[model samples]
Target: MSKKKNKSKTLKNEPSSLHLFDQIYNNPHFHDIVFLIGKEETKAYGHKLVLSMNSPIWKGMFYTQEWMETKGREECLVRIPDLDPKVFLGFLEWIYTRKAKISHTTIYGIYKLAHKYCMPDLKQYCTVRFRKILNGRNCLRHAERSVIEGISKWHKISLKYLMQNSKKFMNNGKCFAGLREETVRTILEMKNLNCPEILLFRALKYWAENIQNDLIKKNKTEIYERILINPDQKKITARKLVKKYLHLIRLDLMDFKNYNELIKSGYYDHRILLKEGFNVVKKFDLKAKTKSRSGPQLSDSKILLIGWCRSGETHVNDLINSLKSGGIENVTHMDPTVSIPSLKAMQRYDAIVVRSSNVNSFYKGGNLGSNLAKYVDEGNGVIVIAINTLINNPEKQIRGKFQNQNYIPLKIAERERSEQCSLGKVFKPNHPIMRDVKTFKCKEYSHFIKTNDLNGGHIIASWDNGYPLITEKRRNDNSGIVVCLNFHPISTRITNDCGKAWLQETDGNLIFSNTLSYLIKDKLSKLAQKNPKKKIFYKK
Candidate 1:
């Protein structure tokens, strides 16, 4: 036998505490047991943990320092990948508190820790603050680098995004081509930049280049006037000429790093107000789906969305993606434009959601055919994308002060309504979506919807102009509730107009979370009823 054999035997008897601790700490509640047992005697008194102790994935989501060491570095918050230095400080607070609060600060080192160390709760805090400080037109160079750090972290988390947006990075004009292809490939493979901010930087890098081609040739006669007269007049070195002008280009001052302190230390609350939807909507639910799965009675089902991947699609894709990711059982989709119309093809889903305004039907008149509206109205569960928008305008407005679970419309129009942010606007304080929305400071901007017959509907979200942007109607004249929204926010008149997309980030967060919750609650309750929990009451 060898000394290695002797050591291996000792290891088997002693057991690796790191491995055992990792197995146990994953269940946060287990700490309570140790606490109950008293700390000094924990090593011997605690029961041995084995692979059998595997907890559900949810329990595993919580990470500890030991775990962080095992996972490589970096944490990612999907909210804002550009964890600019401003976002970094907030991440620090989140790490300390385990609660994500919005902050505006630029501290790259802290964000780097959050991204590397499995610190999402902290990362989210940083993202909120970053968003606050950088909301307006006054973006500076110091803040950009920090945001770039965040973007890089998110790249570590989502290759889907990197793979999807690769072309955009190549096209954004970064002197990427100037850099050696091998270097560019390594950076891209490493996911080194926030995709969007990376796009912006690449653009800036191009503009900063000194190279140029004379489009319409200027007279060289004047060019010779100074150089030809030369040293007799005054001599200047090439480096001197370059350095002097380098001081002149104010754009060179654009560094994301420097402005980050303002994000952390400045008036961020006011910045959040600069976004049109800041106050109008709310942040993400982050509210986890309860494992209990209690409530209504139903069967295992799936939802198929039609017209989702059409020529124009917006929030629909995001909503569907979220439901699937959240583990909300029983959901699927087939964009009407993507699949050929056939009753058999459409019949696969227990529920069908039409996500766009354009209507194409295989269910219209044939045997396999069920009338489009009638088919949905009679289904077990159906979500109709702005049904009214199918026959009307593609854009819709979002406004009405939410109040007592209802919106008292300040204004209503058949077409898209401008942002109706009015002082009179009121919203339901207790509404789940509005819970985070109350603190949202708002900036005014408009989103369009394809809708009609605004009367006799419950307004869920409204515009500051005091008009209803999202409404639901349930009445005797019509049975199924009408979820009135837009055909596509991106396709509407606001593509680049007022940054309806940027400002509405919160709205997208709110509306999608709410709608998905509604569908999940409705679907899950019904299913839970069929699978009742066993009773286990006892008496002495």
Candidate 2:
């Protein structure tokens, strides 16, 4: 009995049997077939029996007379020039071990190989993982690739997600470039898409610019010389690239200010605008029927937040979530230490929020101030928060001086008063921004803005100490709205610089929510009047 038990235990713990799974994978000792994958022709080893048992395509390639040309060779050489070697190895690993490591980065590549080789199990595995990881950033790319690969189910799900979240994705300008024209047209034709006409137009503009940029990148010298010869060619090519899908966009649905900005955008020819009656002259005409989308209210908008909170000083995540819960669909934060989009790219958002500090590692010398000023001048909204800069930090003050100019509604004073306080007398109580915004308090008092140097701005509210609490400005030409909330807003409970835990105010969230909504409404309103007709589609 002891001898028999020892034999069973030895069989269970045998090294050769235990490591067979690993040895069969990529081991040349038993590999009878070699795969040369990708453009580089990288080699991957596999056994004919294992691959043929798993994939009918591999079975036919190895045994059928159709590939008899490869018979009698020491090792069958299969040229898989389209697949990555690592992906091919992953598929082989699955055949041996019945489990393969998959990730967001490798699922699509692996799926393509699985589909091409007719391995249903691996393809199903890829599909499950792909669906789990599908998101706004990669949905369009995935949908496009799935369509190309004839993956009807995957294409439908991805495209459906994209259409449902069109407004959020479009406003953030994620992965719109290089999509098939047909796919773009299909998205534009989606009646259920909730995006505003202005936002959709901006996304299309981004797509066209990216396409033009790629073309220029591929043939830089040639395109540059051509552009030098005919400077208008750049805009001309941009307009032509998107010409096919123009009609799908409801241009008449856009507000007058945005329509005018589009005309000045130079992405479309003047004649096209005139011919299509997209000109401002036809904006208010009764014959021009303006129809809003069926999704969220036209009040649906996006915001770009450009600022960073130092650790322990502020809670940026809490602020972002608060804004999101407050009806803003998208709030994209651009870390100043990273990259800031150009003014043209900034056009995608209805409003931009600049936190106190405005220094960037990429754009040194504080260029965002000039760009944001130009952004506001181009008929978009801006909210300059937390006064301008810390008074003690001379370096931050110098770097953030530009934020106070151009679009900022007010200039920050030289001093910052850091003391706990509450909202004082309401100067503009009936104002949209002040709606439901009662009982505001801050652990730290904000810097005062120079009232005399408001540049035609108005003080909306004041602190208990009579400092400017909330200020707003309207451009002389009616370009866009600018609101300055004059406090170091800390939305989440955290230990302050003084090492004391400060309780967060939910009112802070309401204040920002109200401010963002007010800013967006100010920009997206129709010209001179609101459309009397409200188009509602009842669900079936």
Candidate 3:
């Protein structure tokens, strides 16, 4: 029994047979297969059993009885002339150890080799690693090759992720010049792209210019002279190159000012613009509409309201109903704690109103302020209502907490003073926001924002003490219009449900509705100015 136990223990202590096979890999005496790769005739050695087991292609090539008999052990060699020597060696390492380092230079080659050899595991590993390494800085260098290989190899999903994440880096004009056509098309189709369409259009133009420049560089001196003599032909060629991408540009979404500039620059072909239904006259009409309050009426505008009014249900509900009756059809309310819509989502609405007591935490957590600023800069409108909640008491300066204060037209005071039952006077009686309404009374709690004269901000309404209670900054060349109300229209008593006893005031509600109408009307008027008029002929 003791002798039997000793024999059993010895058998259990022995290394597994697969471990022995691992030791034989790349061992010259054990290597039964040789692969000669690339033009350099680089050599890689491996065991037939190990290679065959790991790869289906290798199994079919080396394990068939006829192949084994036809190519004797001593003279047998498998040549992979398409793969790079370094890449084949990297594959060999992975086959032996189930691991290999893949760099940008070697990744393409290794991926191809892995696919050719039917090593699905290695192929998948390399594909995942390739995506991990791709980023904004390095993407421009690798985009062309990566797209070609990734598409051909059926790694489309990974490639898409890489392209989407790296697009922000393509903001550089030169970087865009190097992108493949496929890469540009794919990026433009992405619905969730963080970049504005105008930037993409500029990049596309740069790419077209580069193509023309490249054509000139490759031609004979006489051909170059001909191009210079017939510059229109060169322009035609560049236009043709960019034609495939023009439709991808969201011209409708571009601000009238920027679109006008693009048309006036004449960098692109007029014929192409006409084909896309983008006539310069139409844009001019749209611009004209902006200044004309009597331009064609627009469809009902959508407005987003954020933050709860400290005032009771009557005040909040009354304000909402007033906006609806004033022609603002759709109103969506959002909780401050919820994630704000992205800039792309914000584009759907004509105007946005943000009101929050804990506005700082809401802005920081949601990362919304910059996106909002961009939205306004793109020619949309924003209304910010500041309420001095208890949260603002400990943190005295409410203005400093605003992450996007720079975008706000009014200069907010660092400190806020509390006043009871103050009356606000109309500073700008003729202003569009106050077109229908005149003077309004403020509740017990009201805050003030100082104005910067250099910013071209207008104080449309002021407190009895001379502090600006409401300010309007019209959209200029650089940014969209912003209206800041220092005091809440709905009283805190209404928010606390105590003001329900008092009937909803018509004056305050009318002012809020007028403000909404002014923002929408202003935006539409600008749009109409750029719109081209269609001529109708009368049949006599």
lDDT of 3 by residue, 379-429 (tens): 777887644421233332223223335556554344354554253677678
Q: Write the per-residue lDDT of candidate 1 for residues 1-540, one digit (tens) a residue.
A: 699999998878984554445343324443321111122222211212321122222135334565447542343212234334334333323433344445333444555565566556455655555544542122222223433554653332223233333444445454332222222333333222323332433433343231111112445344333232243444433333223223222221223332232234232233554464533123322342212112221123455655443334455555555444322345555543334345455556544555443344322222212333333333223444442223333221111111112221122324453452322243454543343443221234444543334655666665545544455544332223335543233322234343333233334444444554454344334444555784321100
In order, candidate lDDTs are: 0.37, 0.66, 0.61
What TM-score goes with each of the models? Answer: 0.32, 0.43, 0.43
Better of 1 and 2 by TM-score: 2
Ranking by TM-score: 3, 2, 1
lDDT of 2 by residue, 94-179 (tens): 77776788776677778877887888888888878888888878888887777776778787678667766776777775356667
Question: Over the full model, what C-alpha lDDT does candidate 2 score relative to the true structure?
Answer: 0.66
Worst window of 10 by summed lDDT in candidate 2: 494-503
The clash number for model 3 is 23
What are the per-model C-alpha RMSD values against the true structure? 23.4, 21.3, 20.2
lDDT of 2 at 259: 64
TM-score-wise, the better of 2 and 3 is 3
